[model samples]
Every structure is written in C-alpha cells, then in structure tokens.
Target: MYTKKSTLALILTACLLALLLVAGCAQNNPAGNEAGRPEKQGAVTVTDFIGRQVAVPDNVERIGCLYAFSGHVVAMLGRGGDIVAVVEGLKRDVIMGELCPGIGEALVPASSGAVNVEELLNARPDLVFIRSETAANEGEKAKLEKTGIPYLVVDYRNMKEQMYIVEMIGQAVGEKERALKYNEYYQRCIDRVQERVQNIPLDERVRIYHSINEATRTDARDTLPADWTQVVGAINVSVNEELKFLEDKYFAGLEQILLWDPEVIIVNEAGVADYIMTNTQWSSLSAVKNNKVYQMPIGISRWGHPGSLETPLAILWTAKTLYPDLFSDIDLVAETKYFYREIFNYPISDQLVAQVLSGKGMRAPKGKAN
Candidate 1:
C-alpha cells in the first residue's frame, strides 16, 4: 500500500473524481450550461431587417433607442414613455422636445459614437432598438448579448425599407395596430402626391438644384435628395451617375451650377439658401433671380432624409413650392398642423411652425433664429 507507483495512481484518481464532480454540478445548474451563461426566459424570437434572429422579451416595458432615428419612429408609435435611453444630442433638439416632451424626462444619454455598455446596462432596458449597421459591430453585439438585454435592428434607407422598419418596430414594441394605422396614413399621403405629379411631362417638370451643405455641394440623382425632387414631380439638376453611390455630399463648382441654371434650389444646409440668394456668382441663376431658393424644413429630423416621419409633409410642401399653381387648392399651414397633431399628438403653434419651416433648430445654418 505504500508503493510509490500505487500512491501516484490514487492521487490521479482523486483529482479525476473531483473534476467530474465539478462538471456534473455545472451541468445540473439551471442558470446556464457548463459555460455559466444566463438562461433566456419568456423570449420571443424575431427576424430583423438584416435577417438576424433576435430574442426579445414578450413584454417590453422599458426600451432604449440607440439611434436618434429610432427615437423618431418610437415617438410616432406613441411609445415615448417607454424609452429609457437615447443619444445625448436628441435631448437638446428643439424639434424633438416639441414632438416628444416625455423623452426629455425618461431618457438617459447613452452614447454618441457607440453604445456605452455601462450606461446602457444601468438604464436596465427590456429591449434596445438600433440601426441594422450598428448591430453589425461585433464588439457592441457581444457586449449587448452578455448583458442579456435584447436588441432589434431596423433599416430606413428608402421608402420600402422605412415601411419595413416601422412594421418591425411596431411588432417589437407591441404597437402593431398603431403601426398599421400609421402605415395606411403614410401610403395615402404618397398616393395623393403621386396621383397628381405622375402625369406631368418630363420637359414640363421643374428643374431643381438641392444643396446638401455648402453652395457648391449637392446630391445626385437616386439619392434621398433626388427622391424628394421626384416625389414633388421635379427634375434633379445634379444627376451624375458617378455620384449615385456616394451617400455624402458631392462637390461641384459654381460654374457647373451656372451651366445647369436650375429653376428651383432647395437648401438642406442652414444659411446656404441666403448665401446663394446674395452671392454675385449665383445672382444670374434662374432659382436665385426668381427668388425660388427655399430652405428645407427641419423638425424632429431633416425633411431631406428618406425615412423621416415628416416626409409626407415634406412632399406636400415641396410640391406646393415647385408648382404653386397646381397645388393652389392645398393649404400648407392647415396640413402642417393636422400632420403634427395626428402623428405626434402635439398641436403645433403657429410660431413653432414658422420656426420649423425656417430651419431654426437645425445645425448647418447657425446664429439665425426665426
């Protein structure tokens, strides 16, 4: 019994037994498998826009909107009270403050560049909504999974994608009926604009130059800016196939714009409208000469962005601007009031409408308040 070989074997056997016992205990534990991860309970699986199967809670009471755009969609669904966290910048946005007042009180600032893991976890949200691209970040995804909080991804790059995003968000937040109602309303607005503008002859359509930021920067055809022009039955003068894939602003020379000589100029950047109006080089342009240069409306989001909730109103307003004679029967003031009331449940004051139309709360055109 005291042999060296026999003693070594007994020690080995005892160590093996200990390891087996530990393994058995871990397997028996319900908290997780052998890896010690938490178990998901009462989770409903949903396929996101990019086809990722996400396990969301059946009842989502507290929500974190990781993107400002998501906040807009959630507000439209009448679920601003459920939002627990949002980007810091949105809290200070005048348009957001006006549209969803409760967001100011309910949301903690999570992050601007990426999801702040600690801040998000402390918020203790039942679910988080983010853009599809944001979810693709491996580090962020891993962190979110470790916290056991579900995240849903939606895309709003185009009109079809926007509808899909709204529908998906509705399902995630238990606002399916409300989402359907809003979609129906959105479709009708699109139809109304399309029916009137679809038949206008190509040569008869207004030629539009949409300034993206600076006077020389513009959007090309097939972009959101181009889509806005098309929706309003106008021709985008900056139709460059080479710039079609570039999402950011494309640079052009003053001479190029002078050559195009657009009939209307819609400025998305602040103060650029006034700059074009007064610039000596741009004085001879038809848009400038005729006082057809107007600033794009900015409220909860820029009307130029494709997926904005106010896009319908933008289409209506732009159509009115481009073809004042044809759209004479439509009253912009009354429609703006109705849209704000019906969608956001906030009755817009006349002063606020002017501010939004004048792009008062937006970034690019600084220092000039309406």
Candidate 2:
C-alpha cells in the first residue's frame, strides 16, 4: 500500500471486480434482466363508429370481414389482398367474385350473425371488421374478445357515416391516401348531382317509391333509398305516418302504395319491377301505367345497402331515370365506366355494365331478380 505502482494495480483490480459484479447482477436478477430487454411496440388505438376504443396492432396484415359491406369498402381501398376471411354470402356473391377474383382462393367462410371461432382462428387474421349492430350483441362481443383478436365496429347507416367508415378502414389498413382519394371522388360525384338538382322546387320534384324486394318492403324517410331520392331532389312517396318511424325498411301493401301513387317506382330487384309492370292491380299507379319502374343497379354490393359507397352512382342513376330530359347531359354509360375505373381501378366493359344494371351480375335467384 505504500508503493505508488502497487497502489495503481490494486485500484485497477478493484475497478474490474466492480464491473464483473454489475454484469452478474444484470444477468442473474430477473428484474434487472427485464429492464435490459427491449420494450414491445405499443398498439394503435382507434375509435370505432360506435365510439368504442379499439386497440389494433401497429401493423395489420391480415383482416377478416364479418360484414360484406366492410369487405366491399376494403376492396375499394385496393386492399382486397389483405382479406383473409369473409362471410359465405360475400364470398359467393357474383359481383364480389367478379370484382375480386383473387380473394376466392383465400376466403375462410365465417357467419355474419355468429362467430366461427375455429374457422376465424384458422384464418390467422390480425383484425376483424364487424357491423356495429352485430358488435352490440353481448354474447358475440364476449366471444370475439375470447379469441384475443381485435375487432373494430363500423356502421354505414348513411352517406356521411359511410365516408367516415371508408376513411376509418383506410387508416386501419395503412391505406389512408387511397381512402382520401376515394372520398374526394365521391364528394365530386355527389356535388355534381346536387348542383343540378338543388334548385328544383319541392312540388316540381318527382315522387319516387323504392321497393326493397318483391314483398313490397320499402325505405323509410331516414333509410338509404330515401336518402337517394332526396339527394336527387325527388320526394319519397313512402314517407307517411305509417312508415315515417319504421327506422329502416317496412312492408307495404298494394293498397297503401295506391294511396301514394308515385310517379316513379324504383325496385331493388328486377323481378319486382317485372311484377309491378305486369300486375293488373299495380297498373293504376302512374309509375306502373307509364312503365317508369326501374331496378336499382347491383354491383359488388347492393347500392341500397346501408351506407353504400355506391350512393353517388345511385343518385345519378336515379336522377337520370326520373328526369331524363333534365339529366340528359349525364351519359350513364360513360359515367359508369369512369366510376369503376377511378374508384375500383377496374375497367368495366359495356356488357358488364349492362349485367350490373340488369341484375344479372347480382346472381339473382333463378325466378327472382335481385
């Protein structure tokens, strides 16, 4: 301890021993080991349509759509490749099959009403998309939670919410840019129609009766079909005391329809239009007498579905159908092609457009056209 050189060497040895002790503590102590390990990345939390917070993986690769509308929106965002599973109805849909044929091979069938936990797990989806109505079920929510796969509730009850749903899905799928592009195009199409029709006086507006199916079920004032009628400056004839509070669609008898005496009848199914045109009882209605009954277009999804992105096209088509002289500048064929090309990135042939408008591409039942 007296010599300088010996003191220096002793100090160096002590420092080495201190270093070894610290390293040993780090290796042996569970707490210290955990502190040294890298932190896991945090999840990205988003508020769903129902205002519920959903914690999703930072990177969502695989997705399962429990609702066909959700699947349709995802496909429109150019992320159809990310879909790992879909409901059997969506997978079997003729328009969907034609639009996203690549998805056919990877579709893991799931039910819209019930969770197929085994099939869902097999699909290896990182997230699932469910309609808000479906997510409200306590049993289904608990079942989905049990799987440990995050799900987001999306509702397309109207156009504003529909746009929001598309944007939300785009963000979830890491395709926000594409979603914005779609919204922009959607707004432009809607604006074009409104700019032309907004000035029409209420009394001058055409009266429209939209039948949901052959059962004579029709849209209420707040439903999508009613929205279409209003957007195009037309009046929904079904908005009476009996149907005003129906919330969605309700069945109407021929007698009730005769009271409305709509000028134009828009049916979701071609067979319904065929029925109306040929039925003697319906001939008294101005729409039937004048042969103004037309079927709504069915594409990848029904245009009448709640919060359908096809609302713009529906508005334009219905407007033209009701007032051909006024909307004559709108070339339906050209507009249909442009819309498919711009929004879906799929070019439509004249034949396909005809099929979509005619209810052929929708795979209507053998005797009934949807």
For all candidates in order, the CA lDDT equals: 0.73, 0.75
Candidate 2: Cα lDDT at 312: 77
TM-score for each model: 0.78, 0.82
Window of ten residues with lowest summed lDDT in model 1:
361-370
- How far off is residue 154 in model 2, in Å? 1.7
Evaluated against the true structure, the overall lDDT of model 1 is 0.73
- Which portions of model 1 miss their true places by more than 4 Å? 1-45, 105-113, 220-222, 244-253, 361-370
Tens digits of lDDT, candidate 1, 161-215 = 6767788788888787777876776677678778899999999999988776677
| Winner by TM-score | 2
lDDT of 1 at 221: 55
Mind giving the per-residue lDDT tens digits that candidate 2 earns over 1-370?
A: 3699888999999999999999777545643333432222566677788887877776777789987778887887777778888876666656566566666665554554677776776676778998776787898888888977789997755677777888888887777888888788778877888898888888999998887755377776555566666788888877653752243447677798999899998887657788888888998999988888888887776566454667778878888887888789988778778777877887777898888776654663453311
Residue 27 in candidate 1 has what lDDT? Answer: 47
